[model samples]
Target: MTLRRRILILATAVVLLGAVGVFAVLRASSRAAEKDRAQDGGPRVTRGEVALAPGDGGRRIVFRNMAWGPHRDELATVAADVPEGPRTASGVNCLRFHSAAGTGICLRADRGGVAESHRAVVLDAHLEERSSHPLAGIPTRARVSPGGRLAAWTVFVGGDSYAGTNFSTRTSILDLRTGRLDASLEDFAIRKDGKEYRNADVNFWGVTFAADERTFYATLATDGKTHLVRGDVVERTVTTLRENLECPSLSPDGTRLVFKKRVPGLPAEAPWRLFALDLASMRETPLAEERSVDDQVVWSDDRTVVYSLPGDFGADLYALPADGGGVPKRLMPSALAPAFLD
Candidate 1:
């Protein structure tokens, strides 16, 4: 072909690609605008003061509201007793959130740039921003210490899900009182089977803080297996407690842990089942929830646990008996990452 004809062909191809890109952007914009509009038959949401502190209403359940409306993805609250009632939106948006003793950790996304970014924001009792730190990847799990002096969060630095063998996660713990941050838990020393351990593929995520400020529990994945690791903030070490458990949420009384156990013979897509492990006895009891639960459960009380499941809008909260006997009940619709204030 002639040089002029070749140049013309290249120009035509560039124009076609530009048009396709514009179409994709327009489609995405349209979908986002649709989310801003209130969906018919959805729960009522109103802008209101949503304090992290427990008020006269007794106890409140703060969660990431997933209902379709103007307040979608905002940190909202409801009476702990009546979780399915009207939501009070705090105007603070978060992809993942958790709170304890009036302090909150909110993992939020920044959508303004060409590539999306995430950050962990510390919030005061009044739902106001206290501090923010940039996160390396997509946020997943977040938790605050029982006394509210420490905050922990986990993000997916690679791959799509925790179940994937090639996935990588970065778990960070922040000292709220001193403003100190542990950017990655991998920096801490690892002790497996009473021996010091190290590996290039080691990844950590799904942290749950104990009442004691120095102690915590998290999932450490290495060598195609996940373990429940007991970590010490002061010692800067993590000791493996048990294997095949992920996302362990300790009970308020600190006697047991409710975690997702990868049960054999289950489908790979949904391999986890809720199980309660007695810390003292080293015994595991499978919870009644038949479906797979892929969340770091929140202990609603000593006897009950709450977790999120895929729902119509996005995700819904479900409560189950800690004893592994009672059936799972829908706690609330269009809610995720619940933190109870009492």
Candidate 2:
């Protein structure tokens, strides 16, 4: 071959190698960004800001702003015309129970490098930070009382597998009116089968409060069984009422309990069926949503139930009739952990 041709061939090979190197670096960067979005619960460029619509009276829907990307640690409202609200502390993974009374609670997780830490931050109704408490594990759920006088949350501890397989949960409650904190239900006196029992494996999660503020309901799990327990905030006592309930949410009228019940013979990944229990009659009625829901159901009104279902892009909120015979309807796209503002 001619010397000039040989030189040109070598130069072409060098250019091709450089192009391949650049392409590989770009691909790796894209993957890293995706991982960060998943861990931070932030928004992507394609997912636009959550559109807001005026609600009844001054009420609005407040939820995590996935469109805010890395800055999406705090909650945002659909009421775009309202004054700017408070922002959450850095690394907030979830926000819950934003109330019209001007108060809410959020869960922040710091997963930087090899160390991980979690926190629960209290916010005023305007979205201003109030208090922050150090938490022990990854946050799974959060809630505020009917009048916004109380706040509660659940976290997963022990290890990642333990949380992933539903092996352990740590639930805490705070009285915003009094600034008192019940760090965990394990500290409360518990009664099982109408008798007091002391067991180390007891775990509690899914707290739902009544209008009275002092009376609440939660799920207590131990000895491979889960029970619905009514608790007294003032007395710090929990009495087991029934079994097979997880993540119970009270209806707006305080007359019914919407909760997840584990269905036997199902795969471990999706074992729960949503049901509404009449508080007065104690009759359990299965809702029309047949899919297994892992969320703590939210009551949109006296007769409508809302919950989140995982999707390809993000979790979406869906509503169904609480009366047990209606089809599920989508409420919000790319949203989870819904709170109705008053």
Candidate 3:
């Protein structure tokens, strides 16, 4: 064969092999995705992560004399058999906590419904007296606002009834410095079909303020359905944006919102990775769709979003870059509610 013709044939063969290699890479990636889905068992949870400052010599939220492991899930759940805690997770010293009052360690019950409650007993960053917060009443859900200005406050207005979940509840801006409640006069109400529905069925759990601090978004749960609802902190009106989303978290800059989407193939309790939504054009996109990622989302800066997923074979904390790159890194066996302690 002529030398030039031989080179031409060789180049053609190389091209053909490159095409096959590309096809193989794509096929392998697809297979790996399928395998991940199988291993995860379902959709993952949307999550955000923040780093905490080693305040006062590595001070952390400490839970009371309770088991702090997987075994404790069913155990503490039993204690609140008829109860709840902060939907957001917190570490020891702070431990994870929630109260119907939203800020204190107490229980609030809706009328004619079962009485359920859980309190977090722990010291503050200053290590002063033991503090009380009510938002931790719900266990799997315990979260404090990114800004300390607004806090979940559960209180009974007139009758002996107290606030909990969706019952006439409002947020209190707690002055961690003065130990007083700062009130947010803005309107934070949810209306559906020209009516007001109150109860856990319409509970708002995922509540985070805007970067401008003018608005916030929360997740509303009704029966088994969940929706992402936005509230105009300045206007006091609630807008239902998306549905089937359980926990909605706002990015630091407030231009985007992250949440979890439910896929039909898995159980509701199955984890859901983070999703993002554009506020301007109202565009929605899936950022990271990991399985087994039960979320406790807190933004780390704007580009770097961190969240918690079950790790170490269901015994550790996993942190991933929100933008999606690299395998998740394990921080600790149980590092939750990780927020920038700055």
Candidate 4:
């Protein structure tokens, strides 16, 4: 072919590709704008004062609002007894969130630049930002100690998804009182099978703090196996308690744990079954969900556990008996990462 003709054909292809790209961008923008509008039959949400500290409101549940509207993704609260009631939105937005006592850890994205960045914001009782730390990647799980003195979060530093084996995670813990930050839990000593263990592929996530401010539990992945590890803030050590457990949330009473177990014979996409572990007996009781749950559950009380499942808008909260009996019940629609303040 002639050089002039070849140049003309290349230029034509470039123009067509540019036009398609612009069309895709416009279409995505339109879809995203729709999320800002309230859908019919959606839960009612209004801007109001939300306190992490328990007072006046008696008992309430604070969660990341997944309902579509102007207040979507903000931290919102409702009476614990009436979870499906009208919500009071707190203007604070978080991709992953958890709170305890009067402290909250909000993992949110900073989209001000060309590339999106994430940060963990330490929030007070009034949902005010106390401090913020830049995150290395996409935020996933977040938790604050029961006494509000410590906070921890896990982010997928590199990976397509947490369910895949090739993913990497960075779990960090911050001490509110001392202003100390452990950027990665990998720095802590690990004890497996009653011996010191070390591996380059160790990753930690899904931290759940115990009543004692110094003790915490988390999922530690190493050597292609996941284990429930008990960590000590002061000792700087983590001891593996059991294998094949991931994303453990310690019970309020500190006697048991609600976690996702990789049950055999399940589909790869949904391999987890919610199970309750008795810390004393090392016993695992499978809950009655009969479906896979990928969340790190939160104990609504000492007897019941709450978790998120995929919903129409984003995710929905559901409650189940911690004893592995009874049926799963939807707690709230369009909600994720719930924390009960009493």
Candidate 5:
């Protein structure tokens, strides 16, 4: 071969080799980082506390699915925080809040990626908050401690509204210790609208406490902008943890968090696809995924995630494997979201 030709061929081979090397390095780096994140994050859950309810009437804005089974015919106030209206239920995913006190909160609004406005209503096991706070108009959802002393709500401040909820909303924590809905902006991170934030968003939906009551978990939404801000009951200093997701439901043991995942493409209706994230490392794992999923979910021990799935004409309740979904077991098969009472 001519010397010039040989030189050209050799140079071409070296360039190709360099490109391949760079691609290999990038791939390996991504994998290594993911592995480290998972390792440091630990397991998705240690244990979960789940209640059983049939999936029947959760299709509407209101629902009932603790035990009634096929009899889950009546729909009343589930918990504090669902908007007080005629109620609504779409053909897609619905969010239901199940309290530790056998209370369930249901409302029909798209919250996965959009902000919403709602007439905040607080419901005790007896549904008394409805009459008490007849004038309240801030938060749409909240969590009260097992002792019933602490409660938190998600509310709004500016703009018109989002998903039937107030746009430019803020999260506020209520000290039910005084037995009133005082205007205290305790748990909110900040407010952003579809216009200001463009694509970034943050939402607080539910709050839960540890067995000790020292530290608790709050569910939140920010896509890639925020984590449910954690407040130390003792320190009184709120801190932000994790990067995505919200509405953290602690395992009965209080060691793990079974929260909702708000990925990059989830619509407002299908916000949470049922995922788990470690509170320690903040690494995530998918307990469920990409299909029909209910945002109102809690753990029935460490191995099961009880949630509701909307069907053709109605909603059905089903439990997915906490470790990883195996063949899903349909509880009320026709229900929406279920909360175990026992």
Candidate 6:
């Protein structure tokens, strides 16, 4: 071979090897990005734009915003301070607040890559994890009792009915202090119309604890009808209270209950209206927020109620008067599952 031709062939081989190295590097980077997204629940976003800062220790609020991507786990102030959307608990997809004790319940899902298995993680007042419990089904709700000694959660289980109007949920309550778990409400004795009732198709969800940790209110669905029932942890008994109520949240004062009630003539997708039921009078008063609120309402104070509404990018927290008047005010943008730290 000529010396020039030999040199040309060597140079061509070197260039081909360099190209192969670049391609390998690109593939590795792409895989790393995918892993980050999986861990963070979504893509990362720039801070100081749609992010809120974690405020001082006292009376803080924490929420999740999938739109914030890596900063989806966020902390803010009860006064609606700019949230510090830091990357805390990167694996927690859902979270809720225990206002009285200043703790939280965080949920993490492991579906191989999608959502299949879930774990209920207990978070301390400072947003640090304490313990986690393995759970079945997709996580939908998590709540801590007023004293924070007990925690409960609900997950949708069985069938593709969640995509449609009908669905089933398996709600569990954990005694945080003793680590005792009531895996399913189905095991509890239920009384309807002052008589013991047993049904295999019965399901319960959306539990709100009373001042006494042993007593709670939850939605019980059976035989194609939904009813609000008051349950006792000690007695392991549930008694039906009323009909057509879902996701009841007890008032901070313990005199009223805020929940979602189905309103006729609305589309099934957005069929609920926020209503306050007086415990003494049993009168249901509709709140001023006209939009469909598909959340368990939280009491910001005795006079104001807070909840999340879905937005274009993510869900935002909104607060309105608890007395059924006044417009709903936006509390935090790109935040959901508002839990006030007291």
lDDT of candidate 1 over 63-90, digit per residue (tens): 9999988899999988888888778888
In angstroms, the error of model 5 at 22 is 87
- lDDT per residue as tens, model 3, 4-63: 999999999999999999999999988654543313232111111212324342322222
Off by over 4 Å in 3: 1-92, 97-117, 120-124, 129-131, 134-136, 153-188, 192-200, 233-236, 268-271, 311-315, 324-326
lDDT of 2 at 288: 93
lDDT of 6 at 332: 63
The global Cα lDDT (0 to 1) of model 6 is 0.74
**Model 5 TM:** 0.53
Flag the better candidate by TM-score, 1 or 6.
Answer: 1
Q: What is candidate 2's lDDT per residue for 80-173, written digit by digit as tens?
A: 2231222222233454443435577878766786997778988774455689888988787888888778888988876543224446789999
TM-score for candidate 2: 0.77
lDDT of 4 by residue, 1-342 (tens): 999999999999999999999999999977755554458566678788988998986899999998888899999999999999888888899999999889999999999989999999999988899999999999999999889999999999888576788799999999999999999999999999999999999999999898889999999999889999999999999999899999998988899999999988998888999998899999889899988999999988899999999999989999999998999999999999999999
Superposed Cα deviation of residue 260, candidate 4 (Å): 0.3
Which 10-residue window in model 2 sums to the lowest lDDT?
Answer: 80-89
Q: What C-alpha lDDT does candidate 2 achieve relative to the native structure?
A: 0.75
**RMSD, model 6, all Cα superposed?**
8.4
lDDT values, one for every candidate: 0.91, 0.75, 0.46, 0.91, 0.48, 0.74
Q: What is the total number of backbone clashes in candidate 3?
A: 54
How high a TM-score does candidate 1 get?
0.88
